[model samples]
Target: MTSSLFEPEPGKDKEASSASMPPALKLSLEMGPLVIFFVANFFGQWLIDHVPLFSSFEKPIFPATALFMIAIISSLATSWILARRVLVMPLVSGVFVLIFGSLTLWLQDATFVKIKPTITSVLFALILFGGLLFKKSLLGYVFDSAFQLDAEGWRKLTFRWAFFFLFLALVNEIIWRNFSDDFWTNFHVLASTIFTFIFLATQMPMIMRHSLEQPPSDKNEDHAD
Candidate 1:
């Protein structure tokens, strides 16, 4: 029995080690970096005024981009520490954050950070569609075994998500390119969250129809008998 720094202890159950963290903690780990980015952007001027180091930046978004990069790295590290593994989607997004966020800071341009979401969304859409070419529902792999569904269900769901990602990419491009920075920031924090929730809610019927897990109600009825 050998183990590395990240590996579960010899006596620990592998499933337990990889099991999802508590919902509240998981949500915090995932959303905390975004909240930090929003806050940093909103308070950039204040930071620049007080923090002598930030005096070089003319706009808030650049500082925001730097903080975003740091926050995202911290978030991913925390997630890995807690869950023993980082989820695929956040890891992918974090990689882009580092890349584009660094480009934003290094070049002293906001466009890189602003277009990060659009690029990431498009990449995800491409990955999903590419998987479908080989008859694979890559979304399942991306989601880290969250649930199971029939093959047809996976194909349908994958198609829905691929198109949804493309739609999100389009929306991101429109907002960031056509709107004020503050407006785009607000849309990123608020509207994107709402849109994702709405999209997931819309998919509940399909998820229920194809869910491999038995319903609680069915288990209750069986117990009664």
Candidate 2:
């Protein structure tokens, strides 16, 4: 096919500049904040106790909350440095983390931090499903760099992902609400990862089948060079 869809971008050496990294690395980078949040929670109390101003937050969960905000800030700063663009979704998430995390510390209650996953999950599901109602491939926008798909394919894949997100939100809510904090944390980490991997595997066939076989039109190719 004589198409420019696969052609290198002009004026930019994508292969050298930033394209050398694989999709999984890019995704992990985007998930930096969540990862940091988890790590901070595990060691935040001790870290906070060391900081003079935060020494008042020396209480277990209180210190954790302070450290969580610090991690969120660190994540956002790194994202801005690497991407050089404002990531809307993660920015929203960081804002929530700062706000609710601070509240958790102020109130000395763990409920605020516990609610984060539920809120983020429900918000994600609602946004995804709402896009489906409008016949838009919302997932395409989020995952555009990871994979390519035709219109119909993107729509179908998006709808399925949207429903899956809703299901995940329900699962998070139930576990956090009814279980001990330690058990809920374990489920959030290990169980959620397993669930996501399985779901992605199940969608592979559909993704391959629906992807566009032909490249995009050369006429639409950018002439940035």
Candidate 3:
């Protein structure tokens, strides 16, 4: 989506109105699908028993996966409709959901679905690190709409996120390999979300430290002259 959503109008004081994701809207777009997936998985049997709508599926995970896939696609579409473009992160995740989710259903193997997060995380990590190799801070594109940071800040933030994504990938691999399906599912929805938010919170001091000083706009400079 265009960073304009976060940018202030020309005449406004930039410091008074920094670009940012509206918390409620951000949560809805980011967490809404995951919440749906979790609820479907946790209460699959109950849903099948209580609601005739879900009775057609013999297995619980199948229906849950189907609903999860649908929710994710819908969420992405909604974001696009609202923002007039797709955010890179969600767009990438949505593509993986379509690919692996289809495989999971077609092959009737939860393995595909289970590995989706790992694959997504690893891919993102690689992309971030790869950009750094070429002297690009691609993560800035992802967050620029919501934050104003100097070049150094973007570089540091990108490096930290690259490592973070790698860490998440490793954790997902370990969990899904050793844990039960239910446990892994819960981890994906609950634990991962919590950990991600905590990590983001921990980075606040760095973000503030690296925030770019608001420069005088051309109009303001002209007025001053």
Best by TM-score: 1
Better of 1 and 3 by TM-score: 1
Candidate 2 local distance difference test against the native: 0.64
52-153: candidate 2 lDDT, tens digit per residue: 766766455556566667766775565556544334466666787788887887787778877887788778778878877887666764555555666766
Q: What TM-score do all the candidates reach, one by one?
A: 0.83, 0.75, 0.81
Over 1-225, each residue of candidate 1 has an lDDT whose tens digit, in order, gives: 433333332224445544645546656777888899899999999887888878888898878878888888888788677776665677788999999988888888888888999999999999989989998787765432444565666777888999999999999999999998888988998899899889988987776666657564533343211
Q: Is candidate 1 or candidate 3 better by lDDT?
A: 1
Query: Which residue pairs show backbone clashes in model 2?
Result: none
Distance from true location, Cα of 96 in model 2, Å: 2.0
In model 3, the worst 10-residue window by lDDT is: 216-225
Per-residue error (Å), model 3, residue 67: 1.0
Instruction: Record all residue pairs in model 1 with backbone atoms less than 3 Å apart, i.e. clashing.
Output: none
The TM-score ranking, best first, is: 1, 3, 2
What is candidate 1's local distance difference test score? Answer: 0.77
Q: Which candidate is the best by lDDT?
A: 1
